[model samples]
Target chain A: MPYVNIRITREGATAEQKATLIQGVTQLLADVLNKNPETTVVVIDEVDTDNWGIGGKSVTVRRKQGK
Target chain B: MPYVNIRITREGATAEQKATLIQGVTQLLADVLNKNPETTVVVIDEVDTDNWGIGGKSVTVRRKQGK
Candidate 1:
């Protein structure tokens, strides 16, 4: 069983969109990796700005400072 | 290019253990799927008791009710 984990930026995508994305991923894994969707697990995490970092900066602070 | 999403039990693992698990998963994906670790993204999500389900029931409620 292949378990897929998706860490999404908070407020980037709606819950419905996330669910659909997971379903699409599920299909991709099944078709591409020859895995079983029943056994495949997909988790989408919403990371807060402080919890996420990019370009050596905290997303929360950068956004607040309008950088 | 392969993204792996792992939805973990909220309290089932410690942060260190989770990190190790992610590393292990990264290795496995590289070996089995021939994916690159740098490009492979693994996301582990800790779910609250009320949010998880199994065996047609909520894991949180079942644990609380001791069922």
Candidate 2:
């Protein structure tokens, strides 16, 4: 059995949207890889922009700079 | 920091393709959300056809049925 775990930052996702997104992604994986929906898990991590950074830049700063 | 983890079933990805996919995904996250590339992690799980199922149906069976 293949176990796929996804932990994504919850940026603009509303509660309903988050649920649907998880469901959609789960369905996509299940459909494409023939994995059991029960075994596939998707996790969301809601973090502050200050806490998340990429390439040595903070998300908040990046957004402000538009880069 | 927001942590995003992805575990995907390796289908047709060559070794180089897999590396590039990881790099691209990491870069995408970094570029979009300003996340540190060092913390972004992507895992790949190569599973047999029988181990993965979606919607209560085996992937291989689904493929056979043209679903």
Candidate 3:
């Protein structure tokens, strides 16, 4: 019952890519930890740049400043 | 990197409870695993019962049936 949440910037990622990501992560955990993929829960959260921060600055601001 | 995610039914948990939960989990990891609370990322997701499932049934349906 390993639960994994993957967070990424809200850039355009196709649904197919998301599906692949879920499968890949599940497989990786299964291979390494021997966790059952059937019970493993995977959630993907796409966060807005304005809401994501780095080094006390929002990603939105950092991108605008070319940092 | 120790990232903890808490998922609960969207049944009106107060801000104080959320704060306590964050602190409690962080402390648990720090005490047991000697993890750094400063770097441990904690995320709480209040999922609607409709979107959460148990025993092959959505929590919404389970609640409706008094399960």
Clashing pairs in 2: A34-B52, A34-B53, A35-B53, A36-B53, A53-B34, A53-B35, A53-B36, A54-B34, A54-B35, A54-B36
lDDT of 2 by residue, A1-67 (tens): 3443445554675677557646665665555445578776776667677776777998789889985
Misplaced by over 4 Å in model 3 are A1-67
Docking class of 3: incorrect
Model 2 sits at an interface RMSD, in angstroms, of: 5.2
| lDDT (Cα) of model 3 | 0.76
- How many Å off is the CA of B25 in candidate 2? 1.1
Compose the digit string of candidate 1's lDDT tens values, residues B1-67.
7788776668768888989978999999999989999988889867754434332234454576685
lDDT of 2 by residue, B4-58 (tens): 4545544564677557546655665565556678777876656555666877987
Candidate 1's displacement at residue B19, Å, is 20
Best by DockQ: 2
DockQ, Cα level, model 1: 0.07
Candidate 1 has a TM-score of: 0.51
TM-score of chain A of 1: 0.83
Per-residue accuracy of model 3 over B1-67 as CA lDDT, tens digit each: 4777677888887655665666677778888998876666556667899999999999999999998
Output the TM-score of candidate 3: 0.52
List the pairs of residues colliding in candidate 3.
none
Q: Which scores greater on TM-score, model 1 or model 2?
A: 1
Q: CA lDDT of each candidate? A: 0.69, 0.62, 0.76
